[model samples]
Target: MNTAPRRPVQLYRALLAAYPREFRGEYGAAMQQLFVDQYRRARTPGERTALWLRTLADTAMAAISEWLKAWRTAPPAARLVRAAGILFIIGGIFVPLAWWLGTLRPSFDYPYRYQPFVQDVLAPALFMAALTAFTGGAICLLLGMWPAANGHQRLALLSSALGSTASIVGWGALGLQLGDSWWSFAMGGLTLFFLGVLWAGLAADARNPLPHAPGAWVLAGLWIPVSALAGAVYEMVTGRWLDGPDWVFGLALMLTSLGMLWVGRGLAQMPVQAARAQDGGDA
Candidate 1:
């Protein structure tokens, strides 16, 4: 009776442990025995190595499939929160698109230099979409904070709310040709504050993956304050608000949009258990 190689069998059994606990408890021994039998029946070392590689690949694929299944079957609240995060990402993307389009006019003038199509059509549409998107995102995020709300979640909620309100006020001010008025200043200030709060919360959360992505949210967060300060200083010195080049403003908008997209993607990808932990639940 030829016995299976002890080392290879042991390794195979160890790999089986990667499966879910319930699955391992039920079928682990049977699976190990089957693998050992196959190992003993192999004709050569090459065959055994091939079997081991196949098993590893299958195990990895199975693990990913199980995780996707779990996400699909997660509770309704978890799904809603993830959906809200997606909305945030979409809304964030629109911010830059609107700004870029508005700046593509013939002149780089202060506030009213936009082409007719940009001012009459795209601007209003984008602003309305932003208002709707942020408002919906805020409501969903707030609802997702049911049982226990962490500081980060609360900050996200507040930021979304402020963003929604600012969009509404901004749209109205634009309609009344008050783009450079105090209302405009107030909207800009509110937007900066919201971005700061959101970035702080995201940075503090260790589970979020935004830090790993290109153009991390930290840089985006820092850019806003720095740009605002620089713009202010320029205004004071030059005795004009729009003295800076147009590309600088465009760059700032791009950074803000990218940062929000990264944060939203991170939030959407967070596991249900981790999200619950944000509300004081077991991770």
Candidate 2:
């Protein structure tokens, strides 16, 4: 009777991609050997199939384990701290929105009696909406940490979806208030376009681990500063500031940098893990 190797080793190697870098590096050869030994011992075809199934399942579990710890590639306590920071920024946006919706409601409703479109209504509303968008986007940006730490991709997607929706809604509300002035219209158009782009790119493809996505954290980090700096430059040029807090611009910059640092740290881990995985596979 012919008794040759029945199972293909390549299938097992392919499945190993699901395992964590460290686990695969240290125990992959040993595990592969064990699998080969078991395969050789199997008396029936059913036993071989069951063994392959188990191997795949174990590899899948290992992948999940590594994904959960992905945030360790980031800063210490990065998830908790970033979440809190985002919450505070969201609160800041609410403050101005509350103030305007309370103090300026009448002026906004009956614009004929006051400065009408520019000072009394649209400007404040647009400014408030922009800040609200910033807050929403920032919180969504922080969702990356949660997903990385806990393997909560669903939660991450939901958070990012909400944030992206808020930004788009807020931008649209503000866009409608802009008058016929070319510059104002252009600015509103640009803001709306950007909101749409983010919605399409990040919000739409939340499920896929697109390499370009950088998750929400990096996007938010890049977004907040650009928004703040743009707003600041606009304020300086137009002789106006958002909510009378010029310092907030600097704060936005600082927080944005911190977010970037977190993301950068995460990216740095990829190479190390890849190297380890390669070395382990070779062994």
Q: Relative to the true structure, how large is the alpha-carbon lDDT of every model?
A: 0.64, 0.48
Highest TM-score among the candidates is held by which one?
A: 1
Query: Tens digit of lDDT per residue, candidate 1, span 1-283?
Result: 3458788877887897566443566678888887888887778989988888888998899867764675576565566666666776887878777776666655664345546768668866785675566567666766664434556656655665666566567666767787556455545744554464355455444543222453455544556567766767787898886456878877877876677677666656655665555455566
TM-score of 1: 0.58
Candidate No. with top lDDT: 1
Per-residue CA lDDT of model 2 for 27-96, tens digit only, reads: 8888777777777787798987897788778777877777567545533333333343344344334434
Separately for all candidates shown, the number of backbone clashes (residues 3 or more apart, or on different chains) is 0, 0
Model 2 bad stretches (over 4 Å): 1-7, 66-283
Q: What lDDT is obtained when candidate 1 is compared to the true structure?
A: 0.64
Residue 29 lDDT in candidate 1: 83
In candidate 1, how many Å is residue 105 off? 4.6
